[model samples]
Target: MKRAAELELALAPRAEGVTLQRWLCGELRAAILAGRLAPGCRLPSTRDFARQQAISRGTVVAVYDQLIAEGYLSGATGSGTTVAAALPIAAAGTAQPRTSAAPGIARAAAADTAGTDDAATKRPRLSRQGQLLANSPFLSREGMVLGRPFSPNQPDLGAFPHALWQRLTHQQGRGLRPDDMGYGDGAGHQPLRRAIAEHLRYSQRIDCHAGQVMILSSAQQALDLCARLLLDPGDTALVEDPGYPGAARLFELGGARVQGVPVDRLGLCTDALPTAEEARLAYVTAAHQSPLGGTLPLERRLALLAWAEAGRRIIIEDDYDGEYRFDGAPLPALKSLDRHDRVIYLGTFSKLLFPALRLAYAVVPEWLAEPFASAISLTVRHAPILPQAVLAAFIGEGHFARHLRQMRRLYGERAACFQHECATQLDGLLTVLPITTGLDATALLPRGSDDRAVAAALGAWGVEARPISFYGMGQPAPPGLVMGFSACNEAAIRRGVATMAPVLESFNAAAAGNRGQAVAGV
Candidate 1:
C-alpha cells in the first residue's frame, strides 16, 4: 500500500516582514522540487490548503499562481490542481577528457568549430539605447508611477464586475461538456463570433456577419496579420505621425517601409499622404486619435476613404476605444461606411474588459476575409477558447452592456473631477488639451520644460502619468504629460494631483535657475 505524508511539516521558518503568501509559495516549491510531491499528485483545495497551512485562502491562491507560473503545476476548471508531467533536470555525468592531436591542426579545427557554433548561436543585436528606452516608454514609465495618472487609454478596473465574472465562470464550468475542453474553432468560438457580430451591428453600426470577424490575440496581432496579407518587403505603408506605437512597431517589424502622415485637428491629413508612390496600406485611428485625441470629422473620413479607393490602398482603421465616447452619440466605425471594401476595422476588448484578456477582433473586407482568416489560422490557430466562451456568455447574458453603462458613468465622474482639479490647481502652469471624447486626457506642460524630468518627479510621489513625447514618430515632441483618469476615483484624483503640484513647482524653479546659469555663462 502507498503511504501519505504531511507536506505542511516541510515548510521553512517565516522571515520577519515577509508575507505569509510568499513563505507558503516557497515551501510548496521546495516540496515539489524535493520530490516529496510527485507528478499527477493533486493539491489540496484552497480552503483545505489554507486550513492545513494555518493561512488564509488568499495566501493559498497566491502560492498556486506562483507554482503555476513556474511550470510546477497545472490547473483545470473543475479538476483540482496537479503537478506538471516533467521537471527539468541537469546532466549528471562528468565531462570526458579531450585526446591530443597535432597542436596546429587541433587549433585550426577548434577555431573553425567555435566559429561555426558562435554563428549559429548569434541573436539579432538589440541596440542598447533603444532597449533602455523601450523597457518603459515615456508614457508607460510616467503613467505607472505618478500618483494620479492624467493620461488617456486607462480603464476603470474597480468598476469591473469581478463577482459577476466569478459567478459566470463557475456556471460555465458546471455546464461545459467534455468536448468543450478540447481545441475550439480556428476563427474563434462560433457563439463568440456571432455575439461580436451582433454587438458591432447594434453598438457601432457595422454591417459584418460573424464569418467576417476574425479573432486575434490582440490589435497588434490583427495589424501583423494585415501587414502580412497586404504588405511585401519593399511595400510602403502610411502611418499616422502621432499614433499607437504598438501598430507602428508591428508594421515595421513585418518589413514594410513605414511613412508618417501628419495629423491636424481634423486627424490624419489625407492631403499630406505622400504621393511620391502608391502605398499598399494606410493605418489610422480615426475614431479617437492617439496622443492628440481628435475625432476625424465625417468629411475627412469620406476623403480618406476616397483616397484609399483612388490609390487602391487598404485603410486599417483601429477603433481601439470606440465605445467610450462622452460627447454626443458615438459615430459609426469606418468599416461601417466602407462601401468600396477598402477598410479593415480593428477593435479590441482589451480596453473594455481588461488588458490581460488579450482578446480582439478584426473585421476584414469581404475580399480579404478569406486570406486574413487563412493567415490567422496558419499563424496562431486562433485565440484561446475559454476567454472567447466567457466573453460570449457575458455578452449573451447582457452583462457586457450593463458593465459598459456602469463603467461609463464611473469614468465620466472621474474625468470631470480630474479636469476640474487640473483647471483649479495648475491653472496657467499647464494647458489641459481638450479631449471631448474617449478616455484620453492630455495636458501640455510649460514650454521648454523637460517633460521627462517632470514625469520622473511625479513618479517620486506615487502618481503614474505618461509623457507625450513617447508617442512621437520622429523628432522631439511638445512638452506635455498624458494623464489617464479612468482608473482613479475622485479622492485619488484629488490627492494625486495635489501631491504633484509642488513637484511641478520645484521643477519649474530648477529650470529657471538653469536658464539663469546659461545666460550668465554666455
Candidate 2:
C-alpha cells in the first residue's frame, strides 16, 4: 500500500508541457536528488507502478530501464529494482533533511475549497536561494506605482532630460554595427568602461583603468557577484547595521554569514570589526550611507583600510549616491585612500541618471579583473549594449556632469524643505536625522514605536515611505522612517506631512489611552 502511494505521488504531473514519460523521469530524479527516496530502497514492480499511475506497463518498464541504465536504480542479479546506493551526485553530496522548511509549496490540496487565490493555496517549495529572495523585506513589490511623497530609493525622474536621452539612444541604435547588436563583452563595452574610468577619476578621485572596470545591471548585481566569488557557504561577511537590505539579502542567499556592525554618526565602527582575521568581505557605503546618510569619516576610513590590509580582506565600497553632496567638497572616496588594492568601488547611474537605466560599474583590483569578467560572462553574459553606448555618449558629451551640478542644488533645497516640514508638523513624534548628502534622509521615531505601521498608514494616504527598521539585519532597531526628498517638490513634502501629522497624532492618543486603561486595571 505504501509502495502504491509512493508510485502514485512520483508519477503525478505538474505543468502540462512535458510528455508523461518525461515528467515521470523528472519527478523520480528530483525525489532522488532531494533525498525523498533513499539509496537501496526498492521501487515498485513495473506492472504495479503502471497500475498505480494508470499509465502503460511498457511506459513503466521504459522508465525503470532508463533509471537502471543511468545508475539511478540498480538491476544487478540479486537486486530487482533497488535505488542505486552510489549515485554520482550522492558520491559528492548528501541529502537535505525532511525537517527543512517548505517556503513556496503547491496549490492542489487546497484547490477545491480555497478557490483560486494564491494565499489560499499551499506555498510552493523553494530552493535554499529562492527561499531567501521569497522572504526579502527590502525589495518593493508595487508595480508601476505613481510617484508620491517620501518614496525610498527614488531619484528626480522629472528633472531628467528625456528628449536628449531619447535622441542619444536613437543615435546610438542607428550606428550599431552588426557585431554591436549581438552579445557584448561581458566585462562591458570598451568605450563605456573607459568613460566610467575617466568619470570616476575626475569626479570621485579614484584611480582605475578601463580594464579594471566591470559593468553590471545594478549595484545589487555587483554585490551578488562579489559574494559568489569572494566568499563560500558559511564564510563570514561584515555588513553595516542599517545597511542596504538588498545587499544583506544577496549575501545571505549566497550562503554567507553576514554580521552586522553598528554605524554611528561618523560611520561603521572600525573597533567593532572582527579582531583576528575572520570576515572574508565587508560591504560599506562610504560615500553616502544608504538610509542613515553618514559619510565614513577619514580616521575611521583609515582604520577600516588597515583592518582589511591586516587580514587581506576585501571591502565593497558602494558609492551609489555619492555625487549629490551639498556640503563642502565631498571627502575623498574610500577607494582613493586604499593603498592595498583591496577595495571594490561601486557607482550607479540609476541615482544620477535614472533607475530605468539599470547601469552600475565596479572598479576592482587587477588580480580580480579577469575572474570577475568570467563570472559576469557565466551569469548575465553582458548588459544590453545600446544603453551602455548611450550612457558613454552622455558622459562623454558632458551632459552627465551638467545634470549632476543641477541636481546637487535642487536636492539640497528639497531636503531643507523636508526637514522644515517634518520639524514643524511631526516634531514631537519624529525627528529628522542629519542630512549632509544622498537622495534621502531618515526621521527617527519615538523609542519602541512601530515604524512599519506608520509607513503603511502614510502609504494609504498617498505617501510612500520606508520603515527605517527594515534596513537593519540583526539586533534590536530604533524606530524611524526613511524619507526620500529628491523625487518630490517642496509643496508635495509639506502637503503630505500636513495630512500625515494628524493621523500620527490620533494613533498616539489612542495608544496612550490603552496604556492608561491597562495601568488602572493593574
Return the top candidate by lDDT. 2
List the global CA lDDT of all models: 0.76, 0.81
The C-alpha RMSD in Å for every predicted model, in order, reads 13.0, 8.9
TM-score of structure candidate 1: 0.73
Model 2 lDDT tens row, 1-522:
365226545434444565666666666765676566779777778778888877898987888887778878887654468789887674433332121112111222223335445533434578999888888664463521447777866888899999999999999999999988778899998999999899888887888899999999998888889988998888889999987878888888878888999887667878899865558889998877766778888889999999998899999999888888988666789999988899999888888888888999999999999999999999999999999999999989999889998989999999889889888998897888878897888888777678989888878888777887778777566788887888888888899789889778876787788889999999
Give candidate 2 misplaced runs (Cα > 4 Å). 1-110, 113-124, 138-144, 514-522
- Scored against the true structure, residue 129 in model 2 reaches a CA lDDT of 93
Candidate 1: where are CA atoms >4 Å away?
Answer: 1-152, 513-522
TM-score of each: 0.73, 0.76
Error of 2 at 164 (Å): 0.9
By summed lDDT, the worst window of 10 consecutive residues in model 1 runs over 90-99
